[model samples]
Target: MRTAVELSWRLLRGGGRRSMVGSLLTLAAVAVSTGLLLFAVGANHAFLQRAHADAWRHPGDSVANPTAIEALSTDYVQGEPVTIIDLAALNGDAPVPPGMSRFPEPGEVWTSPALAHLMKDLPADQLAKRFPSPSGTLGRDALVHPGELVAVIGRTAGDPATTARRDVVEHLGATGGPSRIDRFETDASWSADVYLLLAGLASVLMVVPLLVFGGAAARLTVARRDSRLAALRLVGATPGQVVAITTAEAVLTAAAGALAGLVLYAASVPLLTHITIAGGGWFAGDLWPGPPLLAGVLAAVPLLVGASAVIGLRRVVVSPLGVARRETPPGMRAVRILALAAVVIAFGVAGGGLIDMGRAGMIVLMVFLVLAFLAINFAGPWVVALIGRLTAATARRPARLLAGRRLVDDPRSAWRTVAGVALTGFVAGFLALLNAGPSSGGPPDELRVAVPYERSAAVAGQAEKRLAGIDANVSVKRTETRDDPLDADGPVTTTGVVTVTAPGGTAAVDRARTALTGLVPGKVVTTGADEDVTGDRLLADLRTGALTVLVVSFLIAITSAGITSASAVLDRRQAYAMLRLAGTPLSVLDRARRQETLIPLVVMGGGSLLTGLFFGLPFAQGFGFSGLIGLAAFVVLGFGGILGAGALSRPLLRSVTADPAPRPD
Candidate 1:
């Protein structure tokens, strides 16, 4: 056992550049996978924490109305009733006062501190005249006024009882404006944010399977080293001992990978933070760092290492016969189906959630994702047949015949490669879809009318009138911004615009431009204060998230696929030699190799891609699937690239074949 372990170590450490290359590739996969998972999980946690803080503190100090009035500037007549929250909602165990509405109306109240500052500009006796006192104060005075920025309620301004709602007040600061006359009491759902954290982690964790299982291809090197392992077996090495030694090597390799991954993860975090912080539209809160986050990092190491070791041992056996002959894993079809089934269950769960919740956009996205994944695996035969027929139609003569024959020659390998290419395609397609979808709702068309903000009632009205003048068929969709806050520079105002139906030829309406007209001086500005911007950083994380997964997993797959296919070809060297001696052309033999590899490559790649899309759909829809057609186009291109790679045959028998000329013995 000691001897075998020593031999394994020596071989691992001493082998030339090829050995080093293989080891590095293995290490790279582990590092990338681990690092990605860590970054994604960490960033998600950090982002969520920041989101909560930002929403509670500075900007979320006021209320936004999505439906009733778009902006306070538009709603504020020269004289109208106003409400200001005197103090923020207090958390206490003591009994509360009654008769005061649990929430307050916008422009109907003011905080004493805020009023004191504003009253700095007015005489003390005149302060009460300009701003009347409200009925109740949690502990302080509520000042009622007309069209003035006063007490900021941190809850929705539409609610009547939030005399001091924290959410309304924070929103008031965010919008850069005065508090409004009407704000609704509402809570933002954080489900999507939670899902982002979990989903991003899962996405990163998926790399584990690819790295562990994919590295199984390297076990072919063990086959080459069979005589060495057998020699140890002959000497006092037990089967268990041999297995232990091999597994230990796998452990060492994976450990190195995990460590590297951790280092990469830790090192990159600050940089990621910098980028996110600099962008700073909304996520301007302190980073999340605590025991839970540290625990998450620690947990990933053993999980990755143990998984890798298990996969390595699955490649070789404890017995001496393990190294004697090449053995393909058993019941591939059932295994593939089982794997597919698990993915299907995941998709069903996600889709079912979306459906039950009546989230139409999410449901639609998930449905397409499910279809894209299933298309790669179950549709392999059909895909081959279709491609074969298509290629046959373009065949000049012999090339066409060869292309058609490839469908039957090694369909599985061909499809695996195709599946891989398709995964990349699906992501691209999904992005394209997003671009095409409505910026806010339904879909964009000529005369698309939308309320940019729910509270911007005055602006919405003005925009509607402008659109009405253009054409009657113009659409006007009003959305509530009761939860959105105005900027600090302006009065709390809701801003939404109506889409005008041009006479078949006109420019699309600029939402920001329309918002500019109704703002109070030094106050409301267009564009900048939407919930979407608050969530933008999370989406940016996705851009690299997908690429990281793709690159690492694809590399693992490629390495594993190449090694396994090469070894399989080597085991069949005698067969190839005999065929060459016979009348079979070298080209046919080469074609056969390509067929064998291409099938599985297509299958695995395509199936994984389809699975990704299926799982990704509900999430995509939640985000809004707008550029679906573009996503499809990207998928098609990815498929073509994979197919092309699979079809190109390597110089077969170059190393395997012996020279015809005799060598001196």
Candidate 2:
């Protein structure tokens, strides 16, 4: 073990360019995977942390609607759902609510790091927006930004001892008379569990691609390694020794990358804190992962790498002679079809019983989702084999014939090179169908509104008064929604919506919306209409979130194709050299390699599209499936895959063809 580790380390530092490149590629792949996995995981944690922060911002206070004019000047702080929030006074003169321990004083205020970060660092003129003072005077401008702490106004300004006891003289201007103070924050329409589930699902998508990346990293220079290990076998090194040495190399590379990834994550905290979600970016502290999870991530990455490396050598370890005479890999079995068929039947049976997507049904759905993903993996090689056979039978030229023969000869290797691309396409296709689904976007007749949670009565009065002025005949209804946590099919934190009846027409409804806007200095969103709200932000984020994983998968697919394609040529250098000596054209072999990649690109890409639609159609919401968009995406991916493989195969083709070197005995 010691000898193997020493040799591995020595080889990593002292090996020639090819060996060094392999090590670097392995390190790069592992680092990228680790960093992204952590980011997804960290973002999940941040969502919850931000939620808890929102919950803690007000304790013991159930009513958030303001009744006084003093806090109104600076009271309009934006909230999680982007509503205007008015702080209340804990002043002795004002009648305080029984539920409140203490409220913020007139000039005192609380804010998250995201808000403070956005406001504090600007010029003196802009600093005024950080905490607007009713009395035109704020304390000295802050030179340094606070780290993770919630920015508190009046910390350096207000005299807490005297301010709470100070007299409250009534002053009415554009606003009405001052009354009792109350504050309430809107609870997320859905529960934490739903967001948590979404985060988990997103993480799975990212982590799966990364697992493939790590696997590819382990096999970076397999053919060369096989040759090197074969020479060792002939020179009396035991099979176990060879495996130990390779595993040592993979572990060292993976460990270095994983550690570097942790460093990168730590460095990215400041930036991550600025990604606006919910209503704002997360606090720096809110984004930090706990020690146990961090430790687990660090341990898991290298172990995965070492295990994959060891597994890649199974045949070699079992028989050293067999390693030297590696055969064309076997094609996938017919069992892949059975697995897919079983999934469809199970989905049908379970769909019938699980009519309502209750907790049990959701659990079953989750299982089906996992099965669908696995089925794609299981069924991929089988489809590739069938495509290969079909193409071979149909081949009319040398390039096509050679490519078809290669696919049929070693379908598993071909599948390995392009599987990531296929999976990415499938995932992308399924996601596109979401927007196509019926219930995804807002409805036409409903208008979305975010009124003060406790100001339901006030909002109704104001809304009615405004609507009465409008030339159009429109009425507004206050919408209240409640979620049952125990119900699996239940709604998550759903945003409240106002149903606007434009009895007059669309023009009348438009006039009514204008009147409502003129009544308040706040935002109003209309569902099925043009209105901006948190849902828009959340959905946009959800749609793009998978893109990062897809990109990582694409990179891995390209890298794997390039390295493995180059290795294919290098592995058969002797055979190519002999062919060149017999006057075979370099272009012929070049075309052969291109054909190999092009054929698989078509086969795998088509299979991916089919699979995506299979899963996506059954699950699409009331929104019609966007078959056109999916088709376009599939076409683009297919073209890109083919071009990428052909491009990567070019440089290696030149080197292998240009050199007619003798093979080592």
Candidate 3:
């Protein structure tokens, strides 16, 4: 145990700055991923809570009137007459109460504080209006008359059988006061949905990279120490001890990193609350790293490292020293079959769930990716053989022949580089395309329109007449909407968007809208693309948020791919040296790496494409995104993979050529 501890400390310090940097870099990646996941999760939880609260605070659920404001009466007095005031007159033509004054103007309506707040700008005092009665109207069905001075109150839901809470009524002013309105509820879902989506995506994104990078680290660290381990074996150390020593060291380091991360995550949760994007609300609570989550983190760290060490050690244990000198290649056939199965299952589940498409397409896509990866991994020799044959004609072509032969000779080494490059190139290009796309040039136009959703036909006609009068040459599009009583405490409006082109810039469109709005102030509200609150814009924002998550995951995957490929190639220095001695040139070596790595790169890229297609095609039926967006993603993925491979190759080549590197005879 002491020896193992001593050895671990020695190894930990051996890499000096490189090891520290590597560990720190790994930690940073993990920390960022974990932190984001926690923040997103917390934000989501808080948002959902607030949504439920807001829903409870409104009273439209039980009320028969769905609208924020209900107009009770609009009666005419004797020819040039005015509305009279009477509490009972709400039901009929009752005379005004003995002493109260009646409003004598048109467009006057009585309303509660909430409703009045929304219409503060309206001349309610001069126009007849009723406020909620002071005692509350819970069971009464009576309405208010012109001069009746009835009160209107805000209602909040409580226990089913109990009296619901009501707020004091107030008259309308130019800047209305607060009343619980139902319209706010419409966009409330977004408050919670954003956090939930972010949290879920962040969690998923972290998992893959942790697995890939952790596995690579363990594999590289253990393999690099095998010579020392073998010497310990000669000194009579048992295999169990070898396993224990190596595994213990790894677990210790991993635990240290995990603890560091946990501490950092806990510390930063407060700051994270304010870090919101896309209208995603703040994180509202302390991060609770409960037993299960903490256990997962602690367990995952050690398990990842330990598993890699065990896998590597098992091979060493099974092989005799003489035979060990000649490393046995991993079987290509086995890996291909396994990877195929994995790819199929994952894609099948994901694709089916995403598109309401049966699980079969998803299954096939997943299976293909897994199979493709396995084939590259296990059937390295077979792939090399195929590539070798394909380029066999170039055997006499010097660099080309050398590249082909080298790839065929040891496909595993060759393909790792390929995978790295492909990942880098694809990511880089995908980002470029996003920036290059016209849609990404600026924020999407904000859609705004006026109210009267049901009366849109009449409203649109009025708008068109007004527009024509102003020489706007505009077209009016009618739309339907459910009122959001909360937004303005009245009937709100919704509409499908309309495009307007009036021989001038957007400014001209605005001017035209202003001219029309001036003509018909209350009868017609804009319900098309000219309104301030367009549902489509919100929907688009949500879609953009989802896309952002996908892009971030892709980037994390690229970084992970680089680490895995570099570590894998670096661990097999002896094998590469042997290949070099056998006269493999740099070009052939690079080709083999590209082939192996590209298999997975292409598979993942294809999988992403299919995933997008599943969503985009159906969505396009309603709203379209350009096909070039997806195509660009694929191209970027390919280039990223290539670049990553090339970058990792330098250290790989150096490692391969370093001597006295052990020779695999």
- Name the candidate that leads on lDDT: 2
**Models sorted by TM-score, best on top:** 2, 3, 1
Predicted candidate 3 versus true structure: per-residue lDDT over 59-103, tens digit per residue: 223333222321111111110111111121122222221122432
Each model's lDDT: 0.42, 0.56, 0.42
lDDT of 2 by residue, 517-540 (tens): 423332433444333333454554
Name the better of 1 and 2 by lDDT: 2
- Listed per model in order, the count of residue pairs whose N, CA or C atoms clash below 3 Å is 133, 14, 78
Q: In model 3, which regions exceed 4 Å deviation?
A: 1-3, 11-206, 225-235, 256-299, 320-323, 334-534, 575-627, 637-641, 648-665
Q: Ten consecutive residues with minimal summed lDDT in candidate 3?
A: 72-81
- What is the per-residue lDDT of model 1 for residues 56-128, given as tens digits with 9 covering 90 to 100? 2121223343222222211111111122322222222211212134543434443434344544554433234
TM accuracy, model 1 = 0.52
